[model samples]
Target: MKRYLPLAALLVSACATEPAQDLYAIETAPIPAAVETAPMVGKGDKADDPAVWVNLANPAASLVLGTNKDAGLYVYNLAGEELQFLDVGRVNNVDLRGDLAVASNDETNSVSWFTIDSTTNTVSHIGDTPTNKDEPYGICAGLVGNTYYAMPTYKDGVAQVWAVATDAISDGPELLAEIQVGQYGQLQLEGCVFDEANGQVFVGEEEHGVWKLDLNDWTAAPVSVDTIDARNGLVADVEGMDIWAGENGEGYLVVSSQAADRFVVYDLKAPHAPRGVFTVVESLDGAIDAVTHTDGLDVNSAPLPGFPNGIVVVQDDGNPESGVDQNFKLVDWTLIQAALGLE
Candidate 1:
């Protein structure tokens, strides 16, 4: 049976500790954007989040899965070519693992799913899961042992973490945990990613900050991963979050400092420890322009072509090259590491 628990009330019942009051705001840096894909198919604010699927057998031939939101998912090669498009109908905030890609669809008020054939690199729509949330927004995929989880958050802050048995065989998302979170500023929130390494999930609370909540402990209160304070370097509309975890619990929590037009990095071991913030600037080669007004982003430590170490992609809301619609920008993660002295 599925369970729905209100986090605000659970905090009182469970006797959870208060989130840390002290936050670190360090210096910021600039990480240059290498290349950006062509703008999204339509006009204002179309290109959204990105998910990188590495070809385990052929890392160099990896694919970048992005959401058009207005239409469906777009499969692009490393070079930013449109290999395929699935008109799944307004599936926003996409994510994938192995052969499956899942998203939050406010259009259908459900969670949509898609599959990709690794050999042929083609995509097929499987369908969407039943949703009870009023307006589905940010969505992410996670795993515990071998079981899959589909976590979709409502624009009003209701988050449903579903244990998905609906892969190649099933279609329903069995509710594992349904909880509430904070939604500030215009009843909005976007971008969520799971940290399978530490068994934690991070949710971006647009106006407030990022929150770190344990996956198994339903009663525990959500801790503040980081917050936006203009006195510090961070600005409002804190968007797009991703985790880059390597072996032995060594990694970083990256958040898009949208209002300030930069991305901030934090130590995963000590999540609140501010490492440095960075902006994806224009390429010196004039190949791409700076990244601004980023919404959702993705990062992976697995080595792939061009990016010998890893890669990260951010939604570039800017129209570089004088384009009309927004597109995603691919950056070398190592460059960001080196720029922020994370190496």
Candidate 2:
């Protein structure tokens, strides 16, 4: 499936606008000291992103799939126990479609498929797409009728969107559309989430900010909703994004400010603008670098009653000196709920 390429690649210049320095460091109520950490499959391996699968039949057995950038993909049980590993080599982003979990491997610039065994909390390799010249980063799964959409990060400044048969794992992914987003700073494409209800996709350029694209009409130019320069108290390097569906079935978009170790939650109701909800600090060691470079996030309604409806999980690009302990964090949504007070 990876046959076509754009005629030319162009990089978008960094926006000249700048916001004032962030004076407020995130301060919040103490997190649960008893919170358990997810077990690691190997020491020194950087775990970058995660996608969660809730097992309705066995609620307590839900699985959390994570990427080990230098290794592959690892599956863990709800209790944070590493259950299995699928070695695809340097996977950076992961998403799910039915029982299959798809991952983008940066090293090989390809996407690999894996089948999830919920009953046993395991992952088995299915197949992979043809390789590309651009390193693949963030991914989002969208379904249009029977076709599944696999969106890859920009290579040479163009993001390619592919359409694949949901059940045909071994067959290569067919290219459906290609969108060229000029490069911005060191930011390549890193985060993406589909607004299925609206048939739109949000792509994040690390340094430039986020762009909204319509799936139905690929020829229409993308609309830029927000940029790093507009966000206060955070760095320009934005990485991961997740949409939180509210009680009314509407939602908000939560994005990571990688360099500042914080998050900017945007209200999707009205003009679809950003409102700084709250900042998440590195609670483990209270070091700035500990939580810096936050990437990949997933939100799931808490199964337990009275707890906030959702929980936000983030990856910690740990300080280089803290060898053998790279990790991801599970942030309680209750505090964020209190801060936003959204009904």
Candidate 3:
């Protein structure tokens, strides 16, 4: 069933003249608990993004790939144990498809890739693709039939869409499309996700807002789904976007509000339509701490052991327990959905 937000949501967003949620603010959702936590491999501040590779045969064995911006990439298990660590320079963001994973190698300003072995729960650094940009920030996968595509966002607000193959096609990726994102002079861009089911590409503009373009036609103009300035529910520096696919062409577009330490949820059908914003607060079960200053995150609908429906992996910039650099937290999707009253 197709789900659409109330008419009021569209009316308010059309003019962009009033606050989206004046006094009508969504309450914080209890995070329940952290299933697992993967800390950054390097000593400095790392653990920027996470990409989960589901082990279809056994959901409990799924592998989570995350980036350590200070050093390299890390491979972890569903239990959050570090399986492998491949030092391939600084990788900012990463995404997985089939047996391949692509990343933004900020150290060399190129696209780094890996071959995933679900059985071993490890990823081998295969090759690198130059992004042709000074610094590549975020990266995600796009698919056309059996073919794979890599979409990388640069620090200059230029996002390059490419058709990439994992089997020794080339040392780099083949550019298929390119679009310069972000608004005003906000060149810094990050947090992007490809709606493989839908025909859209959603990306975050740090100091500006969230924008989406047609996945089939990148040359087309983009539509601003949401924006942030001084007075609004969304705080400055909009970051990290993830899709929670639901039944019947329905889901949510979750965005990380860095400055406010809250997460905003939007209807998947009408992404521009506001749903409700929620923060990860302390759980009554007293299992995990609240999440603050999240950078990159990912979610899956597949059911697992602890999370029957699925789970969300979010990079926690603050590690209060160890007082370390950063780490990624695994949250139960069922609790989030129940709290938000999302079907």
Candidate 4:
């Protein structure tokens, strides 16, 4: 079920120039995926991000939602079977909470909403509402009490907090506030997650690192929790991130170090200390290939199928085995915890 290869074997060729000590990634053995989604429409970097929806009544029936940036959103079963496809073009990133699913609709320059029918285990297109930003880049949504809040980022490092009404999915969300995450027009900010428990949102500045904004105070400046430092094992282009929730507000924040083909973990709580780093490699049977050049990822701590402690779904830009298009891969969070010796 797992394969242990030499750390040197996994070192990417791009890192040949940098001194080995500069890379603080734990270099744990690669973990294989439990399942993988069907390839995207047509080849060449189509799949971008994924969202996991747990079926409380039947955890085995939980679903995975992903975005095919060129085509639309895909609904897949735990087994990686394509259940449904919503043809909303150029959806960059997606996140779901409660019954509402929100994605960054790049084609329309707005945020497209969808409804998750738990009764039927299906997702349907709700509608989209315009955004003030010219390029509606990445997004994440979560419930802060009874209200659903969505944080959508733009290429220019500007992000907005919106309150989406479940009763009116088509009408879009109410813009609560807009904050400049970094120097305007100088930052490429995307892939954000709402830490509702902390009343803050963590945004990734692709080339720089991760920054946090306290939702309670929109006027305050963004805080740098981590930077593109070798000590933290962050290469350029930190793509996607999601929190691995634990009981009593204890958990870890997982981030994608895209250019390096690895993911870094940090304490979900502030000070946000770096925990470990890992990457998905080929399965023992060579069915599913290693994931590289990842764009976005999502994590859930709720138990599901082989992922007893929950699952992590990541965008695999190169589906080497299928030799078709990009797709998402599902890995058990327990495997990651065990690999990194996390509590």
Best by lDDT: 4
Ranking by TM-score: 4, 1, 3, 2
User: Tens-digit lDDT track for model 4 on 214-296?
Assistant: 87788889999898864577767888999998877789999998877789899988889988888888776888888887889
| Deviation from native of the Cα of residue 315 in model 2, angstroms | 0.4
Report lDDT (CA) for all predictions.
0.77, 0.67, 0.77, 0.84
lDDT of 2: 0.67
State the displacement of the C-alpha of residue 61, model 4, in Å, after optimal TM-score superposition: 1.5
Per-residue C-alpha lDDT of model 1 across residues 210-313, encoded as one tens digit per residue? 78778778567777767675334455677788888788868988888776667878888753587877778888787788887788899988988889778999
Residues 1-343, candidate 2: write the lDDT tens digits.
Answer: 0111122311111222553233234432233211224645356647778887767676667777888888888876655567777878988888876677778877777877787776776678877785554677778776777778888775354667888787674676887777876456764777887776666778887778888888788777877867766644335566788777665547788887776556777775545765554555545555323344567776666463223466676776654233346666666677676676654
Off by over 4 Å in 4: 1-26, 165-171, 321-324
Question: Candidate 3 regions off by >4 Å?
Answer: 1-26, 41-44, 165-172, 229-232, 282-287, 321-323
Residue 288's C-alpha lDDT in candidate 1? 82
- Candidate 1 ranges beyond 4 A from true positions: 1-27, 166-171, 183-187, 230-232, 321-323
TM-score per candidate, chains pooled: 0.87, 0.82, 0.87, 0.90
- The 10 consecutive residues of candidate 3 with the worst lDDT sum are 19-28
lDDT of 3 by residue, 141-247 (tens): 87667668888897678889988555534546678877988655566789888887777889888888788979878789878888775333465578888888877
Could you tell me the lDDT of residue 9 within candidate 4? Answer: 50
